[model samples]
Target: MNQPRPIFGTTIFDGSQARKGYALNRMCFSFNDAANRAAFKADEEGYMRSYALNEQQSAAVRGRDVLGLLAAGGNVYYLAKFAGILGLDVQDLGAQQTGMSKEEFKARLVRQNDQPAATAG
Candidate 1:
């Protein structure tokens, strides 16, 4: 038997997840069009309906919960479009995903970059 995957407080976007999130991701991809983005801004509910999102996906979108969205199988790249609609960027999503405040996440990134890589002896 295969071992269970560890929970790292983040969802892995696997094949199952991709299938589950197809509608949501496709809807997000539509946001690439200016008109579609404008339409979404004009009518959030109608826009969601157009995508035929399931209750869980719809709920996640309404709540603006990044973690919830991930749990609902939302792909990060596609969800970036959705987040952009709310004036949030990847850093903001990263903060939400990692359960850190934006400032804390930024600080962490800086610290990580400052660290020297291990040299192979």
Candidate 2:
């Protein structure tokens, strides 16, 4: 039998996660609007409060803790909006998720691409 690969550094975003993340996701979705994004930039705490984010979510937002946000049920797509406000990109998030510097993460990706694909059992 081909054993399943062990996933790391994140959780599955399921119904439970969706429920948990509702407020945070909604807040991020609001960022799609330039006015809303400006409002959030002007008053981050008030914006978070308006969305009713729980303590964990609020803390993750305050800390710019991507992994912590994921653990708090934040969706990456939504979080990407939030990240953009902070001048970060997906590669930045990937580095944070893997506990590596951005350069190291990019190099690792290149190394992986150079390797032959693994055969399925």
Work out candidate 1's RMSD over C-alphas.
1.6
The parts of candidate 2 lying over 4 Å away from their true place are 1-6, 118-121
lDDT of 1 by residue, 26-91 (tens): 999999998999999999999999999999999999999999998998999999999999999989
Number of backbone collisions per candidate: 0, 0
Candidate 1 TM-score, C-alpha based: 0.93
Query: Compared with the true structure, what per-residue lDDT tens digits does model 2 show for residues 36-113?
Result: 999999999999999999999999999999998988989999999999999999889999999999999999999999
lDDT (C-alpha) at residue 9 in model 1: 94
Candidate 1 segments exceeding 4 Å error = 1-7
Tell me how candidate 1 scores on lDDT: 0.93
Q: Which candidate has the highest lDDT of all? A: 1
The TM-score values for the models, in the order shown, are: 0.93, 0.89
